[model samples]
Target: MATLRKRNGRWQVQVRRQGFPIQSRSFRSKADANEWARLIERQQDRQELGPDRKALKSITLAHLVARYRDEIVPQKRGSAVETILLNRFLRYPICQKTLNDLTTADFAAYRDQRLKEPKHRSDKPVTPKSLKRELSPLSHMFRHAVVEWEIPLRNPLDGLKLRVVDNKRERRLLVGELDRLLESTKKGRNKLVAPIILFALETAMRRGEILTIQFRHVDFGRLSLVIPESKSGYSRVIPLTRRAVAILEALRLEDAKPTDLAFPITPIALRLQWDRLTARAGIDGLNFHDLRHEAISRLFELGLTVPEVASISGHRTLAQLMRYSHANQETVRTKLQGPETGESSHH
Candidate 1:
């Protein structure tokens, strides 16, 4: 479409087309301006003008997500889970919007709608924590597109406010639960699960971090293990208990090279075996991650300070570490009555 007008003694013409930015030109003669308008309109219709706008207008968020999944996700540490999140995101209605049409309001609506629904294939409610996890890879996708791929747009999630959520699980191992759990894994041909369970309880390392440890990262002379790569993307040395050291010494293969993973099992295999072991042990409502929480809390009970435990647990903030570390009533009462305490009276 073309609009003609006279401005300041110049014949001005503006041409508009669907899926393309409106363009205009001015000329001394109406004939010259009209010719220019027709040429621009033809170029716009053919998608031959304003390549950036044309590309933006043609592609949808779903397409970019697919590209990101294939090209980017494989390089990430959490690719398995992140791939699933991006694949599920591709099916969302918001993905149908073109780049030019995308806005924060679209994702705001998506965030609310997802929160109201049950989790996929389960009766559990969709939690804000789970939503935040899903959004993590999606958020990085936008950043990579803009910063690396030069997509010419701000991240839509930049200003979106997520609901406050506290999904911390304080479900520590109950009395005798660890023994039963250990005993159950003994029947399996794969012997590493028991020691892995012990190691997690001992060091508070995440499953991913535990699996990635190489024999070279251990310093037996110092009785400390170096987490070469952590979730925080830095190395930290965690002081080892005698029991933790003994567990590692037993597991170390005499023929093992420094680069070989200490625990040879894959993450998927570990997860499947964990579920089976817990069921066989008759342990209810216990997650593998709960071991890390138990370890952190026990460190505090042993009188380790906040910074000390945080370094071992890879927690960047004190508040984050505390959320995972919970003390039971009996434990708190015992601490109050310890020999170091002074006599107390009602205030």
Candidate 2:
């Protein structure tokens, strides 16, 4: 329903459908207002523009994941690996439930079930952080479907208490860990892992960034690598350190085809190779992402300010990088040392 009114010598229409609030707009003429009213009336006849209107039926989580994988993931930066992780971790039993049916109890149950899965029995259970990452695609899909596809949502995740993630627990390699890792990488199962390890150590780059590196993107003369699209949605110039430059020089002389990847490998294979490297290194529980933390930690230790470190690391926020800048007690205690203390052996 709509009614035309005159206000300040102009015509306006106030339109409403059942269960929906009235929507009013000013117009230059009564005809204009009447035209809008006619349009709303037509929609009302078809029950499309009324407050009683309902959105499309609720979709199962599995359906949403499939749609997201096909329509959304391809445009993302780490879509391939992210899709794999999401499917591997979030699929099966839980995916059968509709978005509205995904209660806090379901999330809690899923977390507990995932933590106890037999596949991870030999290793530490899936941490809350890993679980959260696996759930990210669901949140994204729900939000998109609500706004774009007009799917009515109760936001199944709303107010569900999430586990506190201790990012600090898993970031840096301890003393001798790096050296042992390097030695182990030499004997790693995959030939590609060794070069990848060397590059990661030198450049402090993310796994996807390193794997996506194209020879043409490397500016040898300038000793810079132009990352066209980083996680920050901006291009970053990775200025090579002398060690990094040396690695590049060696890679530049390799006999591979020009268009072939510098490290043509899947993340699953890389993870398997890392497992072998860690076993041989006599180390345990280190993920490849820790290499990024190691690089950022070294930068701060060498007196590079957070902003300076962010330049090479492609971190957009100091708050984010601060998590990786966790200096050990020795480093903190060393900072506290002064001439007044006369360089004591212990704090």
> For candidate 2, which ten residues in a row score worst on lDDT?
49-58
Candidate with best lDDT: 1
lDDT of 1 at 324: 49
| lDDT agreement with native, every candidate | 0.84, 0.73
- Compared with the true structure, what per-residue lDDT tens digits does model 1 show for residues 1-347? 89999999999898765445668888999999989998986665454675356768777998999999999999989788788788888888999999878889999999999989897545778888889888988888888876577565557898899976676678888999999998898888789999999999999999999998888998887999998788889888889989888988898878978888889888878988888898789988898999988998888888778898888898988778767445645677876878663756656
lDDT of 1 at 323: 78
Candidate 1 C-alpha RMSD relative to the actual structure = 7.6
TM-score of each: 0.73, 0.73
lDDT of 2 at 73: 86
In candidate 1, the residue pairs with backbone N, CA or C atoms under 3 Å apart (3 or more residues apart, or in different chains) clash, namely: none
Please write out the lDDT profile of model 2 over residues 1-347, one tens digit for every residue: 68889999899898865434467898988999899888877665544653332222246778877887888889876787778866775556877877646666887777788766644425566666777777777778777765665454545665556676574744578899878977777665567777788789778898878887877787778888888787667889978877776776676655755555667787767877787788788887788988887877777787877788888999887778767656544677776874464566785
- Model 2: what TM-score? 0.73
Clashes counted in candidate 1 amount to: 0
Best by TM-score: 1
Error of 1 at 200 (Å): 0.6
